[model samples]
Target chain A: MLLKIPLAWLQLARQKIRFIVALAGIAFVVILMFMQLGFQDALYESATQVHQKLKGDLFIISSQYKSLTSQQSFPRSRLYQVLGFEGVESVSPLYVQFSKFKNPQNGEKNPIYVLGIDPAFPAFDIPEVTQNLDVLKFPNRVLFDQASRPEFGPVVENFHHNEPVSVEIFPYNGTVGYQVNVGGLFTLGPSFGVDGNLIVNYATILRIFQDRTPEKIDIGLVTLQPGTDVKRMQAALTEILPNDVKVFTRRDYINFEKDYWSVRTPIGFVFSLMVFMGFVVGVVVVYQILYSNISNHLMEYATLKAMGFKNKYLLDVVFQQALLLAVLGYIPGLIISYGLYDVASNATQLPVIMSPNKLLAVLISATLMCFTSGFFSIGKLRSADPADIF
Target chain B: MNEKTIVHIKNLNHYFGGKSLRSQVLSDINLEIKAGEVIIMTGPSGSGKSTLLTLIGGLRSVQEGSLKVLGWELYGASDEKLVQVRRHIGFIFQSHNLLEFLTARQNVQMALELHNEPDRIAKVKAEEMLHAVKLGNRINYYPSDLSGGQKQRVAIARALVSQPKLVLADEPTAALDSKSGRDVVDLMQQLAKEQGCAILMVTHDNRILDVADRTIYMEDGRLFKEVVL
Candidate 1:
């Protein structure tokens, strides 16, 4: 017997109001889910900016550092010690400090992180910042994100509370501070959360922060030479470094960072809950709409049954209708979600990266919702007897 | 008398509800419809005429005795088999039962399509059936746009398009006026004789009894008597 899927679709298409309502309900849920997915990704990108760009073969940090973005600091001496180990090609010392920069336009001071790096190093740690070094070479100049410039002006004073916003370096043995000058701004996408970042040369940082010990630094990025076994190098370095230090390969660290944020933060949970709610809402609304439509057309369905349509054929009609509504509605919902993401990103200063992975996840979730909603009505479809019409 | 019987019911019994409040709808009923016969089942309301029709059409379960349509025994048949039996037996309801969404032509074509006939052939057959019912000018009109008599004609056309071995119609002309009702019954009898298909129609209108090849009177869930005119 021929299935009536096409006939069911045609029937749905004829009822313009019902068709539109069902489609819009599914689309609304899909858009809600996509937005939540974007927000979760944005949070992760903001928290792991340095980790993503460093792309190091290995990360050597103090064992006391629970997370890559944690406040733990280590000694600069570890870099030289790591370099002495066989198979180690290069080591870069990185300093991280937070300070406030005054906005020339609004006179408002925005909190910012200043990343100190050595230009002559291999620059493997942060190619994005190091490749654009000309902007950093200008005196009192620093690179700021284009997205952050609206709040903080192109130039600003370094003074806070009648004193230069400078702090003493622990290991470099020098005072480190500088007047702020905005250099070229670039897009870092939605993954980096820093509103304003200051990139400066290692020498400039050391000159400003005085009385810092040369052996102590905040973090170190390590690269292995060609054909060098990273595991062997890590083992060799472990012997010389103090018990307080730790070593991790690139893949291990990325997984560790992702796991850390996903487990330790409420952001992941909140987004997951939003996604779950989106599914529940989608199913409920679509189910209610379909159930009502079916109930309204109960007699009609009985008539079809009387005409010798198998229950399976009747169910195929319902599933086909649901599938069509989901796919048709998802298109507009995806477009609306992207537009909303842009507006929300600018308004909240949060990165809403709409990556392929995130989009795929949202689409799958939406289709699953439609399937579930359509599935919920199978029992009713089977029990609808043609004899009941009399 | 030797003609093949398209439908045969023997001691058929049906009951509604359970032990505490059981009610019999059909009891000890025996009916036989032969090829090329136009049979009318007449009774007052609640006399089980429609119930007997439903039983023979495979729309209701046969609770007690044997019921067979087109040589397929319904009591022992699976639901799938019952549906198969129904495909060869066209049915018309009092309410017309035409899909409101489909045009008159499309409505009639639905049965043919369900039988897996090619679309081109199904459409041509549907159009021819509608034309025979004198609905040629209203092919594209939805049920909502058709008059009562026109809608009934469309329903009749749909029933006949499948070229069924048997046709079961319940109160087919009850909702139409005298002239339209006569036209519908006359057309149904003529089509039954022309196609050599057995037709069993349930109605209370005694005025159309002259068109029936055989008439069976039902009362209190059993065949009360028979009339040959």
Candidate 2:
């Protein structure tokens, strides 16, 4: 039976236009589900890129901080408190702020995220940023995000041509508040909130924002010695630090960002809801198709029933039809979604890579969706009575 | 149960709908059909002729009395039991319900699928059966491409391909013209004799009464008279 195609396939394929229409409808729902799931995945992936790249075993952030996208500053003294603990290897402070960038082309100020770190070691694992760490030691020099939206001017093109491209920053609210030199290009892309990124030295943070005090910092990246348990270090920091700051390991911090977006943000909830709606749409469309198909062939089915074919045989045929539609429709849906993912990633500058887990999940979801429809349409098959065929 | 008897029935009753609004469709039907016997049940429309045929064919459950086919009692029988009983009986419908999606040969081949024969053997048997009905050249034509008489021949081929002991036909030639109808019944008579299967057919076509070994008349759901032609 597995090797031979069932008569259901022949019956469905006999009507070319109707079969194509059904396939198109199923594929439409599949694509809807893929895009929604893709956007939700992209939201989590891009939002947690910084946490994944940061070199740290533990992190300290302000208790009021909801996510990395909305960073708040805590007193720098809290970072020193963790250093007093035994087995604490090193602690480095990271400064973050949503500063405005003066697009050198048209002199328009657009919001760009800025990261300020000490010049001693790499704060991020990005290759371009790590290789060009020496230049950050010079004041007013910053690394430009090459994947930034085009509104940030041609800093990438200018740097490749060996031209000196300069960018002005508006730290709080002033025209040309600080002039930062774009010495090199890096790629951090963007998150759901902020577009474009600029990396600078800790000293440049104070120079750009003169009103800020040096006693506070946005994040404290902490490391532990070899073979030290991270849980013990986390417990020690929690007991020693004040209520104004919170401590988390690298994994927890990444998960916190994901949770904040997935549960707390409306866009995340909307994407998830859209995926569910796509499932509903698929079930409805497929149920109508299978039900109508059964209706059209009611007499034939009754005749089969009259010939001693059991309910299982009829069900197998409908289920086989569902499986075929799931596989066939899913292929085109996934192909189209791949194109949409590229277009969306380029348009939003978010890291929207299609992971294997997401693809497998959608495939399983498609199968289940069609299966549910098949089950629902079996009620119509009940109407096929051998008694009525007489 | 007699070994030579293919179908035996006594005081059979049938109903329609739930108990509160029940209506009797067949009442106290008593019939016995033997091997290679051709019994034509002639009656007006709504005289329970089709209902009785379906009951004997196990298309419907017996509400009362004893009905046995192939030595298996059908009173309070499970659906599984009824399905097994149906395997030994072939049915021909009024509309010649050949699946339009299948060719004439495939339509006949569908009967052999249930017998668990090899695919090649089923094809061979199906082609042989279609050729027996003089449809050799139209073996690959779908029912929609077939004419009225051609479709009925294909239906007959499908029903007899399995060599069922009892063939129950419900107005098998109702949709054909006079000449085609006569030709269809004559063909059925010839095939039933060759296969040695008892046939219980319900029809109002008086032109083909001579084909039956005996003819019974029904009025208002009762077997009123019997005549041997």
Candidate 3:
């Protein structure tokens, strides 16, 4: 009943400039938290985009495989072994390698991830990739990623205008180069580890990497019969497969890639540290605001104590101010962070976007951060002595 | 202690500082204030009159005596007990100590708010008390906009709004001019008498001596003289 006066809000609103400055400081920290968390989420999401797009219930990779960015090839004969298991519908070999792509316009070279698949089977669920399978079947012809970083060249632009886009490709450490034409465009974007992506037929990939033998492959896509137990099938294949290779359900494969980026990389650690720094900065800023506010009004508080109001009532006032700052500052911070996410997504061509979970996470952290500050500043309010007023 | 007595203090002793540096602020103080009584305490600075006033109002611990207000003992009392006693007594200070952000009526309403009265009733009582103090026209004005006399009047309205059993005032008119000081004391005496609550005020202004039914003096932490006006 005592607090129904909205005393906290009235006190804050009384000083317009100081109130705005406090909210702005808090909003700035909120933006910093959002960007760091956004980058971290984008790192995980972008890394697993290709894995999610591949059309298969189960996958096989070499035991030495660290991530998609790494080149780990297993014997193709091992992939053929999965067909012998019951309920197995079909299997296709996928070759992954990073090769040098020479921009057609400036001849600038950058490493591009190349996916080599047999055109006879639809290896990807992407509509653009599956519809352009015939183009990839032709030798030395590839489908370029429309979402790939623009540094790779204007392949998407030229291909859209029905103009010829031909570029040269070289093996990771090879001297000679092979020419390939961009026949179509798809939408698999770039990640932190890989700059651009290309899809080509299996034969063209072997020709580009002359040292690679037909018996070796990077990934084996295994489609199962409809309504079959994918978990049981995975267990059966994993038991029989040689120790040289490993089997994973599609979900586990995505997690494997995400784990490499989120848990095993220093970039992930840095993002987490930056977020914590934002929280510390937020606490200090809010503490200064609340502490100074308490200090400035020490006399009135002492008078209130003399009027029979308890410390509990005064503490409630300070904590209420903290929660108000948390919620009020969060609005502008979230709005501005969404704008920044668009800028970063466009500039980097990574999957940087806002999600409901991220929104809730930032809000909860902001509240906790402000509460921690309130907890620190109440020491001053509790010391206000009624006898001092006399 | 008589049933009509509002405050009873016997052998009250108070000290400041640690053992080696200890100095007595109040010594062997005995006093009694009855219902509807107006008692004024006059003393020089550092004579412990303010300290004694704070103890009677439960603003400070009783330290070494049997001190009772509204039938509640304050010696060795918990913080909670002090607060409960404080709620029954209204306090007015020299500086007017009004919250700068709150309007005059709201400042007066703060006293009644402690009783958990409904907002509608508190607002009415606060406005009526402000009118009684002749501040009806300035009910919506914040402390910054009011003059010194008006602010002190608002403090009096706040002190009497709760219908407290006793009122403690410390130099309530110290900051006002002659005319304003006279007006402030007149309003406080009139309101406290109408509410039937005893008044204990600590001040040095001799001009308002006739307003008190009895006047006492403190010298060197002891009650030195008394005069029944």
Candidate 4:
């Protein structure tokens, strides 16, 4: 049970500058992987914030919907049909589109995503959106997302400070721009695909999109009774609904968006490829360090072998050195990546978060990278013949 | 003296390449070493004294001969058995070969790690051996920080720290000055006597001949004569 002095650690520490350089290289690779993974996470997480936060157990979307960014509308009568199913609590119709907003003060134009919902039904968990339902029910009143990117003008600041705020909404034409008032502030954040957003009543949105009717809806939010099985309800709705519409639980709806971003989009592939490149670069750098260390001490290793040290013991020392490099390097990588995530979030307004699962994943990968490098370097040990030392 | 045989070699013919007699490095070698004794093999370059020394140390496989070290028949012996014998033997080389990264004490402690000694005891014994080799003040000094003579002393400490039953020195004093060389050989002799361990040295340095219990002359891969000093 007694512990031996770790010669591997001592050997690495002997060349302090070399050890520092090795750790620095590893840290750089870890940070690269963190940034790549962070971008990948943002692509999925930020794109599906609405789907994940909707105060409903199940949802219905147009089967023509390609992604959250690419949306289509189905008949609102289809949502009402779900009410006939057992265990159904309520159904809320939501309409979504992207339009340009003309700043009242400067006349600068900014593209913003718009969500319109029935004022009678609370479909989102956002308190600001629910509390000001009366304001959205009135014509030409919309709640601006405070967390939306700053280029959307001072609507949120003006709404909070009691200043005059007005925006001209363009439902595809400049002449048909409907001037509207900022009613309140909500907290839905922006994704890579879109920046800035506002929530309004379904009637208000109908007024802006003059060609669109109230019968067409984007998302059909369905609340279930307590302890109801969502899968059974989803199956019932799928059977009842026509092929033009699709029924999904909230989880599946979120996953749908995730799959779209991760599979159908090139952003996911680019980020994953960069992460893989970083792993390869890290392994090579660590391999060079361990290989050089072994080369320099070939004779010493042979001497140890002559002293009755098993090859396993010699290999253990090298592996221990690798683990030390991994752990020592990972600390700085994790610390620096956290700071980078914050910087990225502030600069881009995307939800670049450090999830526990991703952190665990990167840690395991970093260790494996170093361990594999250790394996590659031990080929030098085979040449450590004690007879050659003479 | 106990006079128990620690090394026995008979007709130990070894070839360097291709199993042919043309590549034979050592030819018809016959030798024996006893407990707590010093045996120095002196010969010219290419006379095969070093090869015979390596064979006796269980370092080379004995081809077409009978060879035994520490009761293990090393002629066609398994690497594991050779390794078991190596653990009981200490080796000193011409270059000292101290690990440049570790301090003198750490280098010596590395030897005990093979034997699975606890860290605390390894450190204590390593320090004790360094002090015995007159390197007490240099225990914390890295090999790069030590003088050539001091590095060799550290090597000696590493070799003797485990109380190995046999010490093999191959031109150990070749890299030192005359004064340092004499001092190194004197230290090896004193430690081998104090520890009651056998010493097998392959050297061409005639100045240190007085320290050996017996000097054997090898010529053309064969023992030519023996001289008691």
Best DockQ among the predictions, by candidate number: 3
lDDT of 4 by residue, A64-90 (tens): 988867879899999888888789998
How far is B28's C-alpha from truth in model 2 (Å)? 2.4
Candidate 4 stretches with Cα past 4 Å from truth are A1-3, A173-175, B1-3, B19-22, B116-120
For residues B90-122, could you state the per-residue lDDT of candidate 2 as single tens digits? 899998888887889888888887788888888
Docking level for model 4: medium
| Model 1, span A1-390: residue lDDT tens | 564326767788888987888888888998999888888777777667667677457788878876644547787777888888778888888766655655555655665666676666634345546666775665555555544545665333332123333321222222333455455444443333356666666555555455444466677889888888888777777777888888877666666677777787676788889889999999898788667667767777787888887777778778877788778888889999989999988876777867889778877887788789889977777667787664
i-RMSD of all predictions: 2.2, 2.4, 1.2, 2.2
Sort order, DockQ high to low: 3, 4, 2, 1
For the second chain, the TM-scores of the candidates in order are 0.96, 0.96, 0.98, 0.96
Q: Which candidate is the best by lDDT?
A: 3
Model 1 bad stretches (over 4 Å): A1-5, A66-69, A77-81, A122-128, A131-141, A147-149, A155-193, A202-216, A231-243, A341-354, B1-3, B19-22
Candidate 4: pairs in clash: none
TM-score of decoy 4: 0.95
Q: What is the C-alpha lDDT of each candidate?
A: 0.76, 0.87, 0.91, 0.87
Candidate 3 lDDT over residue span A1-390, tens digit each: 555478899889988898999999899999999999899988998999989999889999999999999869999999889888789899999998899998888988899999999999879999999899999878889989888888888888788788888899999898788998999889889999989999999898999998888899999999999999999999999889889999999899999998888788898889989999999999999999999999999999999999999898889899999999999999999999999999999899988889998999999999999999999999999889999888
Candidate 1 docks with a DockQ of 0.54
In candidate 3 chain A, what residue range of length 10 has the lowest lDDT sum?
A1-10
Q: Score residue B1 of candidate 2 by CA lDDT.
A: 61
Give each prediction's root-mean-square deviation over alpha carbons.
Answer: 4.5, 1.6, 1.8, 2.2
Alpha-carbon TM-score of each model against the true structure: 0.88, 0.97, 0.96, 0.95
For model 4 the local lDDT of residue A26 reads 98
